[model samples]
Target chain A: MTNRWGLPHLGYGVGLRTVHYAEILSRWPAVDFFEAITENFLDTGGRPLHILDRVAERYPVVLHGVSLSIGSTDPLDLDYLAKVNRLARRVKARWVTDHLCWTGVAGKNVHDLLPLPYTEGVLAHVARRLRTVMDFLERPVFLENPSTYLQFTQSTMTEPEFLSELCERAGTGLLLDVNNVYVSAVNHGFDPVSYIDALPRGRVVQYHLAGHTDKGTHVLDTHSTRPRDEVWDLYAHAVERLGEAATLYEWDEDIPDFATVHAEALKARGLAAGIHREEVAVA
Target chain B: MPEPLTLDLVERWMQTVLVHPESAEAGIQSSPARALIDPGRVSEVVLASGHLTVAERLGIYQEMYLLRMRDALESDYPNLARHLGPHRFWHFVSDYVEAHPSRSYTLNRLGDHVPAFAATWGKRKERGLISDLSRLELALTRVFDAPEDPPVSPEALARLTPEASTELRLSPVAAFALERVRSASLRLLDSPEREVVPREAVPGSRHVHVLFVRKGGQVSRRTLEGAEGHLLEALTSGIPLGRALTRLGRRHRTTRPCEVESWFREWVEEGVFSAASLDPDP
Candidate 1:
């Protein structure tokens, strides 16, 4: 299903990283789009920004941030929001996204995506903050479901329930990370398929697929290697349900060459195509 | 009864535990985490999932936090990390973050105080060398991310009349840095092949000046001679070319016009100066 905001299905893309900058610019690979980490280019006028500008000129670019801290109790960093808005305007980004988590508290940033309790009070708080963020950016913002290792005992609602209500109340969109759903499911012992089935389909404008590390006791969303077979299976399920969403394959750690990463991203396209064909046949 | 776990309390408690310099177990038992919630009730606060205990789950975040900080600092200070070796560098990262935890949204700013922090660390004799290396690496990191102003071309300077040239004020590009560091630190930076530089190997004396500038999206460094460093410093500080040359002539008895011209040509070619404007009143 197409999102309510009319953001395009940007096809298959990779996270634009420094190690692959030269090859990306010179080869100009046939990837559909590139997701630039917002914080990396926000404070720099150096080669990273220069490379992003050139890539945006040739391919679609989206801004994905790690430090938005949207769920933090601290006052929203207006300066950070303003820079993000300016960057979005500069690159004409297709959409901007951050995780549905807090980074720090009491004026200190741990720089990790800390999970939030899915309680009524927390939901109301995050929804209100998200509204302000969306208004400031002058566009709909997407919040991805992070891979969390622990669950709060006080959480009165499930993550999907909280996200569904958040989307309805805040008028925001969802950047569903299938790998996160899988990792969180394994870590928390929940049905991953049920987690995918619970989200508002029209609000899921993008999908993230990545590899993870299994630590025997728990799975870490390392994004270091190729997406495992289980993650691919989950992606196939999501595409069948969500219907042609923009898909991005992320490989942040031990990242392989551009061709290898792109090949991994293309797997989504293949699976998505097969799903699309089956849906057409049924219709 | 303990205070109810509100969102605020939970966030604070978790952060206190995650960023604690010690283990998550100790963090839970620490005064900070205990103040928010009873340490014994950690299992009640965080659920035990699957095969993982409450402490082990919290330990995941605690372990990853220091690793993240170490990776970021290592990226910013490769030479410093290498000089310290993996074992000592890990300890240094642990100590550094405790003293100056990240308060910024970006990790790029996390190492801003590394040089100052390094000065207070290690043996007194080796402190200067370590601080100098940190300062050098920090300058390179800053120059790499500084604003990219269009550099002034040599042809632009040549087009100006000789009279206007003397009165021209040169501005250094935003992506340029002039650092004064010890010669020992320079040797450490230059020798990338060496995995580790023993503390005793670095001589604590002999200082040198270095220039870091970004050109065509790449950062390059050049060590400066004493007179050339003074002249560039003066020009960048807003002194007109004629006055800066005169000051250089006084400071260095052997300053020559031909040598100054050669330095000017090289600096311009290196894209150090972003713009050259006539000093209106000069």
Candidate 2:
């Protein structure tokens, strides 16, 4: 928490959306900071920027971009990355993050986070690219574990091993997505608790809590509803491992009112408190 | 040596799978190695633990591939969406996404292809939804993001004579646009409560005109008069001050300057231009 960048040691937060902009700014709710979708404010020169400007006055802003496609082979889309860097600097983001999965390549964005084969070679590629991204931004970035649907036969590393190596090698931090771990583990058939155990505990700087759809055979990271009980259990484990850091309750789809999302944020705050108290006991 | 594919390479192929159904089957085997039914185990990784039936799980990757993008576009281009109706709209969004997934990191950039893609659909043309409604929404998006250029000040105006006003330079933000049509149906998109609005009716009027705007953080529209639409077209195409005035001579030519003066004042206050170019060629 001492070395935490733009958004350091911030308790619990929520993703900023237009629907909740007024509530965040006017009500000045009892929250730490707000995590904004980087894409919403990027390239927008008018009111959205003005809104971000207002929101920034009240709280810290962290950048989360889905299109970074950091895992894509598309040569780092430097232009877009540069824009992200500029925007992050403008708002003084604590730390920006994108998915460990690829968004798109070959000049198209499929708008979904597809998992990569966890192999030594892939890890090396990510390490190299992540270093370049951090260098470009002039600040360390956090890579989140994507809630993925498919797995490759060629993968050699487990999700935890890959993420730990990613942070340890690239000199980056981890944005442990508790919901993604829960969703992916359930969908793929593994132990969620074990996945948490394997996480890069020390390097984790933040956590994202969100709701997902239970599609029977597989779970989808829909981010449209309230966090489920099972996700809460996983989050408690995340807090226990990573301690108190910046956490976001991501409700991107069917986003409820500010109060609804805030209610969820309070749930995360309560969990985070328990985890912090436990850490003190352990220490 | 069977070198492994990078995340970048997989992301590239994943891009293909969204549009090229062929990639869906290419990446992984058809049948899952094991059957998965439990939803409670949300954090476990079955594949990492050696479950190979990962392909079926990845199918969500395919379904969401279309669903997420379709949702993005429908929010902005409801008129075009309504024009296509649910079935045809889904077809267009699906087909367009397959060919052109969003490349920008922003959701604002997702519908960039709808306008161009509409050129290919016959239903889009017949319905007049693609070009017209698409143009309206896209312009609204641009206006929403356009730099905040306060309209020209009253002093900047009071200082100018009729002759000077004619040659004055203008910023691109004071944009004016129209589709080559005769119907007013496009206005349906401007309504505040968009979800319940009826989408289509028999075509009437040979052409239509409307104004697109972004104010106070929300995008809206206004119907433009014939003269105003003409004036806006003149401005958007980089026409100089006098030339634009001349183009609008049919309505109220620069000869009088009074009528044109009022119009320019209104446009300036609308946050249309960042500033008028002092040296715009006459």
Pick the TM-score winner: 1
Per-candidate interface DockQ score: 0.81, 0.43
Q: Is the docking of candidate 1 incorrect, acceptable, medium or high quality?
A: high
Query: RMSD to native for every prediction?
Result: 3.2, 5.6
* lDDT for residue A222 in candidate 2, whole number 0-100: 83
Residue B38 lDDT (model 2): 22
Off by over 4 Å in 2: A4-7, A278-283, B1-14, B21-55, B124-129, B174-181, B191-204, B215-220, B250-258, B278-282
The TM-score between candidate 2 and the true structure equals: 0.86
Output per-candidate TM-scores for chain A, rounded to 2 decimals.
0.98, 0.95
CA-lDDT, candidates in order: 0.89, 0.70
Residue by residue across A103-135, what tens digits does model 1's lDDT show? 999999999999998988999999999999999
- What DockQ results for candidate 2? 0.43
In model 1, what is chain B's TM-score?
Answer: 0.90
Predicted structure 2: lDDT: 0.70
